[model samples]
Target: MRKLFATAFSLWAATAAQAENCQIIGNQTLCDDGVSGQRIGNTTYWNDGSSSQQVGRFTYNSDGTSSQQIGNHTYYSDGTSSQTIGTTTYFSDGRSCRRIGNQISCD
Candidate 1:
């Protein structure tokens, strides 16, 4: 869940319609999206007071749930999953986002 959340957040922030600059400072990554993240060991802590730990292909959330990524597909412990095809990602719940150049459009 955390991996998906983090990846989705970063990906969206990076490719949003409005240009955003991202920079890495030490172990932390800061972006114009107002979200900052620091990676310590396998755990990633965010400025929004959330964190996740990565173990192998799995990312464990603070709430005890987990998600795993195998290839371009991510599977959640709750039985949900998402798949990415090219620059487009499709979620099990029917949400999807597609990136074209530096812009991303989602629905």
Candidate 2:
């Protein structure tokens, strides 16, 4: 009976530890993978499992738009990079209409 009680207690303790190690925010689950930072929001996974050292960040706007900044890359709402040097525009149908510049190419 003592052995059984010890096993049950260990199981319960393990479960409680796991539950305390993670949090659910928005649609994302922030988990600490022992060495890394915590995760944040729904789309971003942070470092050492630490949310303080964010490895990635994603923001979804109310206008049916979204943006993501991962490392050195910045993504815009139109699924394009914000670092794009040339000027570009899109039509209502979600098609690239025009682009102009020496390094530019129209989509």
Q: Largest lDDT belongs to which candidate?
A: 1
Residue 47 shift from truth in candidate 1, angstroms: 2.1
lDDT of 1 at 96: 69
Span of ten consecutive residues with least summed lDDT in model 2:
4-13
Model 1 weakest lDDT span, ten residues long: 10-19
lDDT for model 1, on a 0 to 1 scale? 0.61
**Colliding pairs, model 1:** none
Residue pairs with backbone overlap in model 2: 36-48, 36-49, 37-47, 37-48, 37-49, 37-50, 38-49, 38-50, 38-51
What lDDT tens digits, residue by residue, belong to model 2 across residues 1-107? 11110111110001111212333344333334332222233223333221222123555433344445544334556644433222332322333312222121222
lDDT of 1 by residue, 1-107 (tens): 22344444332222243434455555676665676678787777877787777777777777677777788887777787778888777778776666555444555
Please provide TM-scores, in order, for all candidate models, with all chains considered together: 0.60, 0.24
Each model's total of backbone clashes: 0, 9
